[model samples]
Target: MLKYQQIALEIEKHIEENELQQGDKLPVLETLMAQFNVSKSTITKSLDLLEKKGVVFQVRGSGIFVRRHKRRGYVSLLSNQGFKKDLKDFHVTSKVIEMDVRKPTQEAADNLNIGLHDDVYFIKRVRYVNGQTLCLEESFYNKSIITYLNNEIVSESIFHYIKEALGLKVGFSDMYLHVDKLNQEEAAYLGLKEGAPKLTVETIFHLTNGQPFDFSKVTYNYEQSQFFIQANNELL
Candidate 1:
């Protein structure tokens, strides 16, 4: 990781470890520079990164402060940490509906940049947060890249396994968000009526080497789902 990005994560970790509330002021830039043993420009870059992520905001005269988020629920769209890590404060659990190695579907093949004849790990799961059904996810992992998977890993966090166990570096993802009505199967899994509106996110996750490893579609219960994203103004 880049130095600024590392510092940005460290600041975020500090906020979480200290249980800093929204609007709580972080230490001044001088203090941060002294603490992190970096120069002013580096600290500024780190803060700018955090600001773009909606973690903190700067004031003309006041110090940087934590940004308030939705009180009910939130999911960081920019983060690849998976639900288990992102919402560590909540009870996040996964029920593996199905898991098997299968030939890649056309969509999966294209998204994962694998051949149609390639075998992939097909996984279906329902994720719950605080005992409430949040989303149903269907994913395909390129077997060549992922190598191995099992029931235990699927029931907890595949990303965790891919990172810690497999020792792979996750890079970024391309995501598309849309609103759709639930189908019968999705409705049944979420305990919602058929045709209920839901938020659907389709993503292709790539590794640091720029190889697409996973393709997934996640349908979230609209009433319980809130998504957050932070973008740099330069991207505009």
Candidate 2:
């Protein structure tokens, strides 16, 4: 992890451990600098990241404050942290439906930018949030890039494994979202009727070097899922 990221986590932990409520002021910059033994620039970067994550907000000429908005079923569309990390306050579990190594399909090959003969790990799983079915995911990881996987890893967070275990930097993902009806198998997994409308997300995940490593299609139980994205004022 980067210095700023570690500092950010520390600040978040401080908020949780101290039971800081919404609108409660966080430590001043000078205080945090002394607490973390880091430079002003480092603290600023960490605060910036926390602001982006909606954990805190800044008011010009005022100290930082917590912004603990209660958003049940809400997920950040811009985050690549995956469900487990994103929903850390909630209980998240995965049921692995299928895991296998196989030759890439044409769609997977094209999306992952690998050759037809290259191997890929095919994963099918259902995710539950707080013990309720949330989403059904089918994913392909390029064997050459991802290197390895097992039931234990897939049962938790693959993104965590790719970063913490493999020591790979996860870059941006290109995601497309649309509403579609679920097929029979997908509906069954999500405990919905066949042809039920679902919010489908297709994503191509890349590494920091700009190499595509994973492609996935996720169908969410519409009533159980909500997503949001943070945008800068400059975008408006």
Candidate 3:
């Protein structure tokens, strides 16, 4: 008796081993049945699981193909955590360019709770996952706390250091998202053209004590990114 779970596991194993890419079709029902000795019902269940998990997509009349990987960075209320509940799930990398530390303007001072005359640490970075450019992030932090940011800080997730090293685990945040055209500087880092479609996110992360920790603006190239939001009835 071939169970659906067994079929699903086999399919999972196949995906990891094969360079099956988006648009690459998997073995059809007959091929799967012949090799796995599974019934049509079980195979159907397996395919359904893959579709729901975003691993495969079904085209009308065209059998299933590997689902193109999408990097979904939206609804990231706690991206301080990671992409998929596990830290490794995020898998994104970054290249940081340190910006000059200077007196913050009125807008910067207000956002980061600093005085207009106070110095602020500004860093720019392009974020990637799986070797693909996904985001361009400009971050501002209170220079009084963060004297400077270097390459080491840029390559890794900033939340990791703030929480584990500096003990600045954020307890809350406010985020707004929108679509916009990429400006010249932003387009350059992200390998996008000026006026390219991009996702813009303005985020304010707060410390557990209700103090602002950081303010950042992140722009994502839609072609290289995908977003996720899970709904739990109980949580709602």
Candidate 4:
């Protein structure tokens, strides 16, 4: 195994041995680097992978801590831009499971203002925390606006690529949040029992010009994460 993966496994073993628990702080980066005889970057990557799997979390200036399974709650959406980066306290990682160009469903076509016969980039990604799947996301992007995308960028941050590489300004998005029972595919991805309750969010993203460019549905493991909305103004 890679050094980083090895380190991640060691950390997980530490947890499994009951040496760490939720609210327990992890060793500092320097300490871990020295203990593992790995470079700082390798240690960081291992911790990052663990964080993505919901194993541990970081506090900005404080330090990393073991994440209790029940104590974990992450906001599904932050703003109109789409997909909050509030995971600063955690090591976030993702895997692009599948990517394809295909025709959209009627709803997806309408939301993205594309034709049902026109092609869209259909991307399926699983976000992990502490080696466990946290969210299963299937996103459809307008081929015209997004232009080009690959698995690498998909696994990282599509939003960042959209802004930095494509120079497209993301305007805002409309989201519908609800609870539903997990389907077969979602259950398989999240390793949840069939029919388990799932926290779901459907989103439609628009560009600065008010043109819709992306549509996505995210299914989260309710047992591992929680979601909430904060509003500054009342809706009329």
Candidates 1 and 2 compared by TM-score, better number = 2
Compose the digit string of candidate 1's lDDT tens values, residues 36-136: 99999999999998988888989879789987564544678877777665577899888999999999989899999989999999999999999999999
Error of 3 at 82 (Å): 4.1
Highest TM-score: which candidate?
2
Model 2, span 35-68: residue lDDT tens: 9999999999999999877789898889999977
* Ranking of candidates on lDDT, top first: 1, 2, 4, 3
Q: Tell me model 2's lDDT, rounded to 2 decimals.
A: 0.89
**For model 4, where is the 10-residue window of minimal lDDT?**
227-236
Q: Which ten residues in a row have the lowest lDDT in candidate 1?
A: 67-76
Each prediction's RMSD over C-alphas, in Å, is 2.8, 2.3, 10.3, 11.2
lDDT of 3 by residue, 15-90 (tens): 8677577788888888988888878987888887777656677777879888644443443433556443422455
User: Candidate 4 lDDT, tens digit per residue, 76-168?
Assistant: 354433333444556667888889998999989988998999889999988877676779999999998888999888877788899889999
Q: What is the C-alpha lDDT of each candidate?
A: 0.89, 0.89, 0.73, 0.82
Total residue pair clashes for candidate 3? 3
TM-scores vs. true structure, each candidate? 0.85, 0.87, 0.61, 0.66
Determine which window of 10 residues in candidate 3 has minimal summed lDDT: 69-78
- Name the lDDT value of residue 147 in candidate 4: 84
Listed per model in order, the count of residue pairs whose N, CA or C atoms clash below 3 Å is 0, 0, 3, 9
Those runs of model 1 whose alpha carbons end farther than 4 Å from true positions after fitting are 1-7, 17-25, 39-45, 57-65
